[model samples]
Target: MLQEKIGGEAAVDARALVKTFGDKRAVDGVSLTVPAGSIFGLLGPNGAGKTTTLRMLLGIIDPDSGTRSLLGHTQPLDASSEVGYLPEERGLYPAMNPREAIAFMGALRGLPLAEGRRRASVLLAERGLADWEKKPIRSLSKGMAQTVQLLGTLVHKPRLIVLDEPFSGLDAINQEKLEALIRAEAADGATVIFSTHVIAHAERLCERIAIIAGGKVAFAGAVDDARDRLRPVVRLQTRAEDGAWRAALPPGARQVGREWRFELPEGGPEPLLRALIDGGAGIDTLSIERPGLHDAFVAIAGASAAAAMGEGAPE
Candidate 1:
């Protein structure tokens, strides 16, 4: 069980959630706790039960077993007015203008139509879409339509926001804009939960993450804790080509060009540094490299999950 931070109440709490369809167990004993006013990522490869778990959390579908709470509501729908959701499948009436579409979404969450429209106008201007506010959804580019939908999700100013695969189909510029929007929401005290197979976004944005693979939670905790599972790598460049200090190198250490690279020794780097200096091995450059989130994901969930991320996998 993860410890909740002081004064940080859980915005979403799920325990041992399981869902089955026919003979396939889509989610098995999955659990997660997202603190309020924080960004959490539900990370996994495609078909890794991310969508299924999210559905169960939102009361869109009930789990065959286990329990969940959303914003302190035992029944997720009871808190619907305080939650905003953007499903992976995007949908908007093509004939409706951006302002109307946004206002319509707000209306679904119990916001008055007139107030929704007012908020929509302000949101559009803030997002650099003021000129397109009155434009029909079909007349806008795909990216613009998606941004309008995202704005619609926020027009009601919900305390909790859930976005499923929000970055899909977006170009680099739009993706950056979405990232900024997410940050701005969190800055204003909204709890943001987004699911994606891409590790870069999670690593860059989330304070905590739950990695699901093969329909189970492979790992869930702080981002740094996940990376700490692997030892730091050491890269060294020395003035001496060969000397008594060579013995100080660990067994798996290898040399390529001018640099020698290996994992940090079990005892620490101090002893190795002392041996190198004492034996006249002049150290030109030395760097201790911490493993990144991609490496941590590969280590925790296996290379298969890493491959599932495809080109989005960090280098």
Candidate 2:
């Protein structure tokens, strides 16, 4: 059994969540765990089975095989009442006012009608939609509608929030606000599982995440762990005219713009200047270059795919 975190319960847990469409395996052998009060990001390239996994979790679709539990409920629908799901496809009644629409959604989440209305009003005001509370959905802008969708998902204060592509339509201002909301939710002891193609969002908001590709997990764990796996090196600068040499560099080191940059692979953090001098690639200035998450992602998933096809052969 996967042990839950301290002072926490297992809010979402799955073991080999498998699903298929005809002969295509959508979510094949996907197992994940989301502890209470943490932000877990589901990341992948387009059509990498992200949506399929989420759908299975939401009970909107069922898996061909495997088991799942959310909030202690074996049946996803029973668990769903305790979940707030924001799908990629934005759906809203354009004619309904924010107050009305959100209340309806809250009621579905098990909030009493009267309490739902009260919560909707407070939530709308908190999200800066107070001025537009009475405005019909059709009259609102795309970002506003997106906000309403988020409000509906959250108005009932579900313990688990599953947000898919939550930042798709928002401007920078609203994006910041939405991020705040996500962080706040976790602070208040909610378990959040959000998916997105945008790596930075996950990198910023998630304590841990799993990257899926071709219906499998390419990487999963804490943000620091992911960074360590990639091991982005740092770059150093030394000028020939202004300076002499940086000194002994490692293999795969390159000199650019009067500075030498070295790629420090994992478990190989040496005193950079000494290494440069020892390698005979000495320079006046030294810079260490580390690969960013995007580069690491491309390197791992792309290399994995290539190796499978025997194309580049993981070179």
Candidate 3:
């Protein structure tokens, strides 16, 4: 399928990307487009080829087949200075102070060392790490070190930022802070893409998302479009017992406690309500509940992905 480009030129455009390790096909024919100035999410369970696809896009590893364009450059290395990346594995010089560490990363991306240090001071102060800026990275907590590394990713103010499993070890508070930081980046007109197995972060932060499973793209598009694949559920509780009125219930209706829960069929709830009333049922309550991203993820990615999610493996 031809990948759809958003906003004229995509920040990242990858087509038919494939990768293999020995005999195992790690990534097979994945295509994705991330619009400029948007928060795009690559979501999948562990070992679903998300990291492989990302590595290919960043020119870290060659794809067995397919092509990619990053920041309008067909060759990612040509635009390397314009992109900031945070790998799934975290690394920072244990002996370096937070300020020096951030500046060093920014310097590698072409930002002047003095300016990098200036921005680092401002960022650290704003993030409530002012007192810790002079401390060695080894002295900071895990969450603090993660935050500092993320600061490094943003210090150069690249046009595109890519992060892999960014929230892997963050506490609830740090996760919230990172979410806000991602929004702030997009707000500043920088395109952002992050890979994760967690659904909540994607649901809350991304406007568009791609779901991958078993080394292939299962679904990709707007979050709402994915959710719309499944219809809203209609839950009804009627005082009437098993009778002609019971036949008015939807085909998939099943009793859950006192309520009959089923998906709302075509033509919507009005028809269902009319059918129940016409059949002389005493309606106690009725509700139409929209499905969330979790429901969409389950429906699109299948049982195994959902099971992995339940196990907290990656999704």
Candidate 4:
């Protein structure tokens, strides 16, 4: 598929967006750039203003003070035909069949009914939903219905896709299917930006991410850059329980059942290994590990925010 390029290389650009609802500030000074054809993530706990920020960027609502460009258009809605948005609220008319439902959604995006129907059939077959294509949405399982909606979002093969909380309420199998679908879209040169509080999905899917907390952006950049905020950790096991080599261990080192763990020393592990060898500590095993996305999120967004992610979907 030939992607319709617009507005240079960036698919999305927002600068200092702010939104207020009554006495509460829903979003504050949020800024980020999403590169075209890349998979980006908007990560945050519920009530953190991720939805509000996305709404502003999509031109669904105006920002109190900020600027945004979508697909190179200063007005995001102008690019609606090129963008596919799956909102947080998942709904389909109970009377409509999967094929009809998908086609209807595509029609809303300006796709002709015939083309949309053709694409919907292909999509259903590809997703193993061919047998259910003619079944009314009310007769399908929740996951199946959601899959139909997702296929509808893609029938037009948009250049930019924005999904808000795409993984919520999905079983493990459905979530994996959604992940594969997302990957396939990006591979076809479509830019995908999804919002999620689940760190695992973002860790696997996003090349870059914006971590929001309390209506503010705590960090935004490459996934690796975020993980690099903390030092790598060292986990070691020694044959000798105690020795002078122990003195070489860095501060904050802790021993647990014949194993020692600590942050990697500032000078690196080479010196520590030498000290262990010379002192006959008899190293059994040693390994250095970088922080994962979950750890990075906790450090960047605070433990409270991480806790909220595990609780449930945000309001």
Which digits, one per residue and each the tens of the lDDT, describe model 2 over residues 1-315?
Answer: 455563657787788889889998988899888788899998776688888998988789888899988788888898877899999999899889998889999988788888888888998887778889888999999988998888899888889999998988688998898899999999998889998877778878999888888999877777676766665565665433322234344577665666555566454656655554555553554345455555556666775543342234211
Question: What's the TM for model 2?
Answer: 0.87
CA lDDT of every candidate: 0.92, 0.78, 0.90, 0.91
TM-score per model over all chains:
0.95, 0.87, 0.95, 0.95
| lDDT (Cα, tens digit) per residue for candidate 4, span 87-183 | 9999999999999999999999999999999999999999888999998899999899889989889889999999999999999999999999999
Pairwise lDDT winner, candidates 2 and 4: 4
Overall local distance difference test of candidate 1:
0.92
Between prediction 1 and prediction 2, which has the larger TM-score? 1
Model 4 scores what on Cα lDDT? Answer: 0.91
- lDDT (Cα, tens digit) per residue for candidate 1, span 1-315: 874752467999999999999999999999898989999999999999999999999999999999999988989999999999999999999999999999999999999999999999999998788999888899999999999999999999999999999999999999999999999999999999999988989999999999999889999989999999999988999999999889889999989899998889998989989998998889999999998899899989998888987734432
lDDT of 3 at 133: 97
- In model 1, residue pairs whose N, Cα or C atoms come closer than 3 Å (at least 3 residues apart or on different chains), thus clashing, are none
Off by over 4 Å in 1: 2-8, 311-315
Worst 10 residues of 3 by lDDT: 306-315
Candidate 4 global TM-score: 0.95
Candidate 2 wrong stretches, greater than 4 Å: 1-6, 241-247, 265-271, 275-291, 303-315
